[model samples]
Target chain A: MEKIVVVGLGLIGGSLALDLKKRGDFKVYGIDQNPTHVKKAIELGVIDAEISFSELSEADIVIIAVPVNIIPKLTQKVLDVVSNETLVFDVGSVKNEICKAVENHSKRKNFVAAHPLAGTEFSGPEAAILNLFDDKVNIICEADKTDWRILDKAISIFKKLNMRIKMMNPIEHDRHIAYVSHLSHVSSFMLGKTVLEIEKNEEAIFDMASTGFASTVRLAKSSANTWTPIFLENKDNIINSLNEYIKNLKEFKDLIENNNEEGLKESMNNTNYIKSILNGLK
Target chain B: MEKIVVVGLGLIGGSLALDLKKRGDFKVYGIDQNPTHVKKAIELGVIDAEISFSELSEADIVIIAVPVNIIPKLTQKVLDVVSNETLVFDVGSVKNEICKAVENHSKRKNFVAAHPLAGTEFSGPEAAILNLFDDKVNIICEADKTDWRILDKAISIFKKLNMRIKMMNPIEHDRHIAYVSHLSHVSSFMLGKTVLEIEKNEEAIFDMASTGFASTVRLAKSSANTWTPIFLENKDNIINSLNEYIKNLKEFKDLIENNNEEGLKESMNNTNYIKSILNGLK
Candidate 1:
């Protein structure tokens, strides 16, 4: 059987371990710096065994699922030790930095710079869920740079996990993700902060925040450990998205101020096209 | 059976009529200026009968479920025609404007200024859902001004709908709701607008906007007919919240620009309190 070593056993890694084990295709070894996560993942049956970096050469595959800031360095380290036959992939949210870091590496063609755009607000091995990557999008950036054989292996693995594969330039992936994913997290967090700052009376806010507020702020519950590096690594694109979002917010505020009912209705109507688009526009 | 007339038979009115009829307490009649809404409500059994505004005198209870912009006037008109025993309430999102509209009226004591914080992103009679008010918050603003007997009737009705009742001054309700509810809608709408503006590739945006973006932008799918009036009716308070929200977004952008990891993590950590708070904060 093929041997797979998963580093950073958080939600993404731990979950990958669980589902991968069920496939009966590989023996998955877990590696996480956090001692608690390693023990918990092993106890939870998320991994077949806990392994160290020194043992990485034993594996045919290495999956790096750490936060974005740590991904580039970790991917480089894994590439340094893993044999030429071993395939390495990083599943961080941001792709640019890690892809750039590994671009000039001797084993660049052996590494598949990929991101599985899938997760929950929860984090760590304890938060690992089953079949998380099932039917989700797995983006492989700069696929042409990866060795054809290695890329084929990566695609087969993602397909076995039931994911749809898309290929794009690393730079384009970072730009689009900043708008779709990172900005939503930031907007949710700040909305939560703005409400928290104002509503000192917690119960009252809770009552008013039942339906709409809850859905709107749901992403605010996401882990700081996971998100900090994403916002930092993708700072440029995030700032650009934020600037556009704020400017639109200000225009909306002005429309409300002037009782521009037509303007408000027009904007909202225009945006309602999202309803159809959200029905999984293909 | 006692008579209850529900004005503007849209989602709230239609749903309320359905649930209220299920209680077998009153004969629920619906009146909507849109003939289509009235026809649909009756077709769906959301209302027992269609009635004219002139027939309101026969009602023992009156619910004004019109859009916020028309709520004050329609509520006043109902007050003009209802019998002395009639208990009138407006279920608009903005309470202050509607509450103030009848503050000095001769029938002021007969009206309860209320806002039931419940709804989905969809709208119209077709969107009316069963038991929507169940386990949701129903705010009775300026309750002291409502006649003792009338307020009891309104509370009993809401209780039958399984709502938890809370009371607050109308002005305070408007201010807080702007931050909790209206601000969320604005944030969602503008977020949608921002992404829609940037992603010229609609299909690509849809693929990336699967989970997190979907939740954050869901409210942008809300009916413009329903929300335009809400943002306009609560303009003052909405503007205040939006201003604070815009400022926070700018500060966050600056943090990202500086790659302030600590600052970014701190903001996200603080906002994570929303997770517990959302679990029905004590």
Candidate 2:
């Protein structure tokens, strides 16, 4: 807990560095392949300084917050460098691959797979903010594989950030996240693509976008580099979700085509249950 | 200019009443098929008082904010009652049908086909709030059919609500809205339906929902009564958008299946243009 190494200076990593630094309890250092982000994180006071991967051995905690595709390799590299007492974790959207990647590593007991359920549409070091993880859910997968000391340290860090922690298997994490997170991104990107393709008049699109459209398409603004991996890594689950989504769309289309008012109404009524779920999430 | 009658006391109608009343520009009265909304509108002071459709003759302007399916009939009734100088407008999502329904009316010149592009997911009088139309867009379709004085009065009213007005053909309005507005509802509802079907563990779904999922699925909370008719009325355009959306999803799926890194990256990069479009909308 004395020294923390955040290995990605993007949104999640940068935010964690800022929060940890503000606590004045840990010396937070950052490492990123992107030199610009590392420099920016230092300049913005997000971290005490930029450190090398070699410094990983001295860190009490190592957090991998890079893209999902890069996370498996990065996690293994960090586990290689960090001491057995150093708790290592990854804040990846998809976790099963990363979990399996290091499941047999000698330092497996030091690594925890986590997904912090929080983010805005923006990215990069500048996109980071204080208290981003506050009051958010942090999902930890394959927790039983981690040593009790490492697990306790991860829990304490999340609690310090005011996050509620939940545990589940990696496979269940991927399946549920596909439905809840990954599929929503696809829906939003397709909605944006559909509107952009059809609306020739840019002025009209800009002028008439109501709050509903804006909110629904917000995730379409997310970074492609970040998302392309998440979608591909969790391909099977995402594809299954997409198939079900398209089927639901087709059923709704039939309802509209046949003017089955009752069926359409019933479908929407059932979907409106999302209100309660959202209320509960909040 | 003197008296305004708003039919339907739901979100759109109630909000219009609140904005016009706050301007102190008109004596605004409300009518709703639902007695609860009628009571709530008066209770919330969203309207001056409840009035019958028979009172339309005395009003200088009448606004129709009913469901899309009821709009054509309601517009016909309003056109029949209002004077030649009295401006009549409907804020239905689908405009072509309402425009066509009143095409042969004697007072067609008094009716301006409009769709004020603003609303929250919540509905009914209780959901109404002040400044709901402020800085929002109001699409006036088939404006050439409305008499000059009526059109000017309609524009003035929307201006008083702090709205930016745009002119469009009724056909174009319905088509564009199907892609931008209507399709968003379907995508969101289907996403909700798909997720709810796959994840019976509500707590897990709720726990994993990030900001992206929450915003993209927000529209699923909309009323079925409000959206069903909109989807049905603009059936062709919605189907077209859904078809394109499904096609895009399939392509994305294939790219993932083949591990076509280049294809996946390119598609996401292209869709990244949405960031610019969204920025412009904001």
Candidate 3:
């Protein structure tokens, strides 16, 4: 069996490993800098075996599922050790930094920038759920820079996982994701913080919190280790998105404070269009 | 059989009618100013029959499920016509206004101030579902102001629906709910508005928006009719929550803009406490 090496045995990597192993072709090797994750992943049967960085030379497929800040350097390190025929990809939220980091690598064509836009708020090996990637979007950036055969192999794998593939350039991918994904996390974390700060009685908050509050602040539960890097690495675009969000919030606050009922209703009605958009997504 | 009249046949009212009807001892009557809701509610079997507002005089249990701004007037009207033995309640998110409105009414002791603390994003009778109130929190504000036997009747009915009951004063209920429930809606609406503003290409957004964005923005699709009055009626408390939310967002924005990595990580870690809180709620 061909070896598929997965770095970072967290939610994304472990989940991908579990699903990929069920395909019954690749010998999945799980690797993580955190020994506990590596040990726990092995105990949970998330991988065929635990492997080391030096063992990557035999990997036919190398997937990096680390934090965004670690991805660029790790991608470079993997490319240095992997076989010439290996297909390498990094499943990081922010794409520009890693894509730019590998832009001038001699083995650029062997690497693909793949961000499988799938995850839950939970992380670590125990959160390795089956079918997590099924029916989710797998965004491939800089595919034109990858080897044709290698890209085809990656496509076949993603198709087997039941993912919808959309190809975009790195800049467009980063910008859109910064707005759609990263900014939402920032908003949720701050929302949770604000509520937790103001509501002194946790039980009172617990009693009053409806499905709406739970859902809106859900992403605030995302891993700090995973998200802190994303907000920083995608700082420019995320900051722009946050500024826009704050401006809209300020406008909403002013409207609410002044009892601008018309403006408030109008804005809410417009955003209700998201109902159709979300339905379409479903 | 006791007659139970539900005023305002929206999601909460309609769902409650369905569940209450299943309990097999009450004749449920649905009433709404919107004739369409009444008609659709009848078609959906969410009600036994449509009743006029004047019929509240004969009601054994009268529930005022209208918007917060209308609840004060509607509760007063219901109290005006309710029999001495009638148990009147208003399912409004903000309790202070309505509680205070009916405080001096001759039938004040007959009225229970309840906020069921349950709902889906969709609204209207069309959105009604069976068991929507199952295992949910039913917050009764100013229970002391209500008659002993009447509060007991409400508690028994809520118990039949499998809900947990909590009692709080009107002021505490409104203030805490402003933080937990109302502020989430504002944050979500602003999130949807922000993304909708920045991502001009809705198709791109539809593709890249993951579960996090979807969950965080889900409340953005809530009924404008239901929410406008809420934000306005709870203006003081809601604005306080909004201002705090905005302040947090600004602080987050500053951290990202200035590359304050430690602050970013610490904030996210702190907010991740919500994970445990949410898990506990489950």
List per-prediction Cα lDDT, in the order shown: 0.89, 0.87, 0.88
The CAPRI category of model 1 is: medium
Residue-by-residue lDDT tens digits, candidate 1, A40-142: 9999999999898999998999999888888988888899999999999999889899989998999999999888878887888999999888878888999
lDDT per residue as tens, model 1, B1-282: 999899878888888989999986688898888898888988999998898878889889999998888988878878888888899998989888888789888999999988898988888889888989889999999989988999999999999999999988888888989999999999999999999999787766777876489889999999999999888888888888998888888888888888788998899899899888788532
Q: Which has the better TM-score: candidate 2, or candidate 3?
A: 3
Q: What is the lDDT of residue B233 in candidate 1?
A: 81
Prediction 3 TM-score vs. true: 0.98
**Candidate 3 displacement at residue B7 in angstroms:** 0.9
Better of 1 and 2 by lDDT: 1
Ranking by lDDT: 1, 3, 2
- Give Cα distance to truth, residue A22, candidate 2, Å: 1.1
| True lDDT of residue A99, candidate 2 | 92
Clashing pairs in 3: none
lDDT per residue as tens, model 2, A1-282: 499999888999989989988864999999988899988998999888888888789999988999999999888888998997999999999989999999889999999999998888789999989999989999999899999999999999999999999998889989989999999988888777778887888776677678477888888888888898998899999989988998888888888889999999899899888788778554
lDDT of 1 at B48: 88
Root mean square deviation (Cα) for candidate 1: 1.7
Which 10-residue span in candidate 2 chain A carries the lowest summed lDDT? A203-212
Docking class of 3: medium
Candidate 2 interface RMSD, angstroms, 1 decimal: 1.4
